[model samples]
Target: MDDSALLQFSRQILLPEFGIAGQTRLSDGCVVIVGLGGLGSAAAMYLAAAGVGKLILLDDDVVDLSNLQRQIAHDVNHIGILKVFSARDRLLALNPSCEVVAQPVRFVAHQADAWLAEADLVLDCCDNFATRFALNQVCCSAQIPLVSGAALGWSGQVCVFLYQSGQACYRCLFADHPESAATCSEHGIMSPLVGVIGSLQALEALKVLAQVGDTLHSRLLLFDGLHQTWRTVQVSADPACPVCSAADSP
Candidate 1:
């Protein structure tokens, strides 16, 4: 590492667990984040500041006045601009050395193979189940690590799934998508609630990148902001789960 690089992340490097080696690992890792909204905003910011070498941001939406309340990565000047473009700009401003690849299109099932194949880790900060399921399927097929999170109202949940570990995936926990899944827009959300969950998501991603510590894999973390409590539920692989079944079949 160069003098400037070491000086930039001196605090992180001072830690025994994350000494120069761990910092170097992070500088060589590539993480793909599939959203630029509430959760994505926080995750991307932290990953960039922590010196993740490469980041691929995928989002199809445009910045709006409403997003400013929770989406910290964007500003008033970014209104009407593609989220991926705006987020990449913000991330570069934080760490110019980090490489940012902006994909300004919706991630669909058909394109999953290509994206998941390229990423070292996948962070699912998306809101809808369709997108989540599609990404999960791709990760399972590619045998990649996935850090997933969701938030609505004052509640949030986060989990990690590694296909190679023979652990349960998001599908195994919630077999079917809810017919009436509430969104932050309709039901409203506490801004800081997203920050809490997003920070947890970043922590999980860092663990995956560093290949250290016990992660949320095989378990689900549920956070209730109103009650200020956290609960962990064991997750087991389901033989009937289509994604896991396919992963284990061959």
Candidate 2:
């Protein structure tokens, strides 16, 4: 790295766990973030600022007034812009050296493999069950690590699936699609709650990318903001998990 980059990431590089070697690993990592909402906003900013070399941001939605409450990346000034592009601008503004590729298209099963093939790590920052399930399958198939996070009302959760390590996939935990997943518009979320969870996603992503520190790896972290507590539990692989039972892992 050049003196300029060393100075740019001096604070993080100074850490014993992260020194120049970790920074080099981070500089060579490619991350895919599937949403630009509250969680993605925080994750994207931190990942870019942390020096993830390449970021692929995907979102088919546009910014709205309601999102400003927690979606920090998109400001009032960015209203009506496609989320991926808006987030790309914000991430670039934070770290111009980071390559932010904006994919303003909804990710579906058909595009999963092609899009996720080169990802070193994937962040499931999108809302909705279908997308989450699809990502789990694709990441598991590609043998990539996934950093997943969710926030609703006064609660949030974050987890990492080391698919390459035979860890549990998301479907192992959620076998059946829920009849309904609550939305922030209907349930109301604390602004900082998503930040907390999203920051954890960023932390886990960096840890995985740099191969430093411990990661969630088959563990689920539940955060109860109403009570200000966090608990982690083991997530065992389901022998009958249709998605991962006879998985195609790379």
Candidate 3:
């Protein structure tokens, strides 16, 4: 590591848990973020700021007036631009040293293998259950740690799936995607609520990357912004879970 780099992260290096070694590990790590909305916006920003070496961002949507309410990664001026491109510019502006790869295309299961294989860690910030399930399957197969988060209205949840340890994947939690559910756009979301969940998602991702604290593996953290309460629910691997079962086999 260069002397200037070390000096730049002097404050982080001072922490016993994240000394020079941990900082170096982070600097060399690669993280892939799917979706450039509320959750992705916050997670990507922090990861870049923390000196992650490489970031791969995926999002096919374009920024809109509504996105400015909570998608801090993009500003009003970026409206109509592809979300991935907007996020790339913002991250680069925050930390030019960090390499940002923008993929302004919708993520599909067929391409999950390549993306997950290349990432040291993956964050699922997508809006739909289909994408979330697809990402979970790919991450489980790749044995890559996946940090998943979701926000709807005033509630959100986050969890880390470490399939390498025979833990429950996202599919284990929700066997089938709910056919009827309200989205942030339909039901409306509290601007700050996304920030709370997104920030926590970023925290979980950092913890997983730095190996600093006990991760949320095998537990679901549910946050109720209106009630101002956080609840943890223990999750167990389903014996019949096709994805996790195959992951454990061989």
Candidate 4:
């Protein structure tokens, strides 16, 4: 790391657990973030500012006026443009040295391998179930850690799936999709709620990258914005889980 880069991240480097070594690891890490809305905005920006070497941004949606309420990585000038590109602009602005690969397309199964190639970690910030399930399956198969987060209607949740032996993958927690999964638009989301969850996702990602301190591995963190309370539940691997179980079995 150069003098300028070191000074730029001196605050993080000052942390006992996240010293220069951890900062170096972050500078050599690559993370794939699938979404550019509320959650993705915070995670991407924080990761970039923390000096993650590279970020693969995946999102096909265009920035809309409504997003200005919570998506901090975008602005009025970015309206009508692809979300990935908008986010990439902001990320680069935060850390020009950070390589931001903006893929203006939705995550698809056929292209999963290509999209996830060389990824040290992945952040599931997308709102829908299909993408979450797909990300969980791919991460499990590849043994890549996944930082999963969700926020809607004043409630948010975060979890880290290490995808290691005997560890739980996302499918273990949600065996089946919710019969009526709500979106931020439909159910109304608390703007700051996503920022809180997304920031936590970025924190977990940095811990996983630097191999420093304990992370949310195999644990579910629940945040109640309305009541301003928090709770954590241990998540166990589902023996009959279709995704992780199949991947683990011979």
Query: Runs in model 2 with CA error above 4 Å?
Result: 248-250
Error of 2 at 136 (Å): 0.2
lDDT of 3 at 31: 92
TM-score of each: 0.97, 0.97, 0.96, 0.98
Tens-digit lDDT track of model 3 for 139-248: 88788899999998889999999886568999999997889767887899888777787778778887788889788999999999888999999999998898898778
Ranking 1 against 4 by TM-score, winner: 4
lDDT of each: 0.90, 0.91, 0.88, 0.94
Between prediction 1 and prediction 2, the one with superior lDDT is: 2
Number of clashes in model 2? 0
Q: Which residue pairs collide, candidate 2?
A: none
* Residue pairs that clash (backbone atoms under 3 angstroms), model 1: none
Query: What are the clashing pairs of model 3?
Result: none
TM-score, cand. 2 vs. native: 0.97
Error of 2 at 185 (Å): 1.2
- Poorly placed runs, candidate 3 (over 4 Å): none
Which of 2 and 4 is the better model by lDDT?
4
For candidate 3, what is the total of clashing residue pairs?
0
Candidate 2, residues 11-76: lDDT per residue as tens digits? Answer: 999999999999999999999999999999999999999999999998999999999999999999
Clashes of each: 0, 0, 0, 0
